[model samples]
Target: MEKLEERFERLERLAEYFIEEMADFKKWVVRFLSEYKREVDRQIREYKEETNKRIEEYRRENNKRWGELANKLGTIVEDIIYPAFRPVIRKYFGCEPEKTFMRLEYINREKGIYEEFDAVAVCQDKAFLLEAKSTPREKHIEEFKEKAKRFLQYFSEFGDKKLILIMASLSFKEDFVKQLSKTNIYAMAYREWEYMDILNFEEVKGA
Candidate 1:
């Protein structure tokens, strides 16, 4: 009877030891799983950030390529400048265009004269002539003025309409805008690189 009791007590101690060992194993498993989950989440976050950055870079590169193609084809005027005409004319002149012409050309064999207009919008009693440049310069302003002087000669039908000249580009410098304000011509460009607008409307109109 004494031997049986001692064996029973030994079995209890062994059982207690096994229970404590199991608890420690469970805790280790939980800690390892938690660390593993955190590592996975961190990896996912880094992957997302890298993917977004690459997508943005690709978008900018694609836009630059398209812009270069447009410039090479001399379609920058049609692409960038033509769309701004109606809104600008209507807003500043308070009249919608009856007809709009793009890339208009005139050749007078008798006078040996040739002229090309980037855009033209004819309203009730007013006409807007637009000249666009990918890269604008001071010489371009003077050249446009000379072209404006001969506009009536080319299109005698528009002679009765009040002529309004406009010069357009992607953007303009402050000095360029100031110089344009001194002239009768209106300047149209991107405002804050967001949308196209007339830059010197009030100054030109008040002049």
Candidate 2:
């Protein structure tokens, strides 16, 4: 009986030792998981910050490039296109402008709206409203058409005069020139050696 009692006591001590070891292992696992989770969260936060920084930098650079392009286009239109157009209009059309107006703004006080013209060259019997661009598109041509169609409504004083719509650009698409000619609008562009030349002059005369 004593021997049997001693065996039972040894078994109880072994059971207690196993339970303690299991509890220690559980604590170690919990600690390791907690540290791993914190490290992963830190890395994720850092990655997000870096990504945001790069995106902001990209946006700033893109805006800067667009601004520079706009400024360059404005310079070309003002310095080269406008100056060359005057001589070409005289040479090709044999019309000398009596008055050259720039940025003519008109407001309908009743409607509370306004329209603007880039330039207007007025002769004795004709007036040409000009739209100048670095790269002329169809939309620009359409806008000029709209303005010229409604010219008399705003400038009723010039009701007897023939209104001509003209566009000047550094370069033009052939398709755009064709479309402009179909509408009887004069499309002019810079040719080789950068002389201002009309693309649709014949069409304008024929129409």
Candidate 3:
């Protein structure tokens, strides 16, 4: 009986040892899993940040390429348009410009902003803000109107001069010309004869 009791006690101790080992194993697994989860989350966050940075870099590069291309194309158009524009204004308006300027860039030092006119022609009691475009769209018309409205703000001295917004283009959409006829703005085309043909000549004369 005594030997049997001793064997039972020994068995109990073995059982307790296994229970303690199982508890320790469970703790180790929990700790390892927690650390692994943390690592995975950290890696995911870093990967997202890197991906965002790369996307931003790609966007900036694309914008830069587009800007350079636009500048080059604009220069070519300006070369053809600037010289012919003044003559058109003279032929139709029946007067020569007192001052003709291209790309009239002005910076308001106080406002820290700048504005540019494609071409500005000032005749007596009249000023024409002419924008030469490879293709003229409706948005160009709206832009010219907005620019003309703000013209007085930039050049307060020209407040007395009538602002005539004109768009000189190589070609115009049919509907665009119709739309221009309805507005105060004028549209002109460079003809095959290399002379300016005012599309809204009659309408302007009537106005």
Candidate 4:
């Protein structure tokens, strides 16, 4: 009887040692996982911030370049291109096409009003609002609103005058353009130079 009781107590001590070792191993595993998870989270945050910074820098550089190009293109078009077309216009219609230049702001009295239209050619009190894009896209409507609308009402106002809107772009979707045409407005693609087909053009002279 005495020997059996001693063996039982020894077995209990061994079992207790195993339970304590297992508890310590579990704690070590939990600590290791917590540290790894924190490091991974930090790396992900850093990656996101770096990506955003790079994207912003790219936009800044590209926008500067585009502005420069647009200015150059505008000068070239006004100088050489328009002159070439003028002779054609004179031969066909006995008149020249007038290109109006406008910015995104208006000086109304002492106050300033923000506007979207780039320019208009007014012939005989008819207003032809012009929106010029070097290369348009399918998602151009959203982009146009941002650049064109001056954080105010996004409206092109010929203002009770003969209202005509002409859009000049290289890549305009036919279906989307069809919808634009339905709005009692005119959209001009590269194919048709008569974008808005303004009655106010010099073609209607002596009418």
1-207 per-residue lDDT for model 4 (tens digits): 569989999999999999999899999999999999999999999999999999999999999999998888666434433333334334433443454445444545545643545554544445444455565554655555454334233334444445444455433566756544543334443445433232223322322
Ranking by TM-score: 2, 1, 3, 4
- In angstroms, give how far residue 190 of model 2 lies from its true place: 0.9
lDDT tens digits by residue: candidate 1, 45-134: 999999999999999999999888776749767777788889888888999999999988999899897789999999999999999887
**Which prediction has more favorable lDDT, 2 or 4?**
2
lDDT, residue 159, candidate 3: 84
User: What digit string (tens of lDDT, one per residue) describes model 3 on residues 45-117?
Assistant: 9999999999999999999998997786688437666777778888888888999888988798998989988
Sliding window of 10 residues with minimal summed lDDT for model 2: 77-86
By the TM-score metric, which is better: model 1 or model 2? 2
Q: Give the Cα error of residue 188 in candidate 3, in Å.
A: 1.6
Q: Deviation in angstroms for 113 in model 3?
A: 1.1
* Clash pairs detected, candidate 1: none
**Clash pairs detected, candidate 4:** none
> Deviation in angstroms for 184 in model 4?
16
List the candidate 4 regions with Cα displacement exceeding 4 Å: 69-73, 79-81, 94-189, 192-207
Cα-based lDDT at residue 144, candidate 4: 50
lDDT of 4: 0.53
TM-score, model 3 to reference: 0.61
Q: Whole-model Cα lDDT per candidate?
A: 0.89, 0.82, 0.82, 0.53
Clashes of each: 0, 0, 0, 0
- Model 1, which residues run further than 4 Å from truth? 1-73
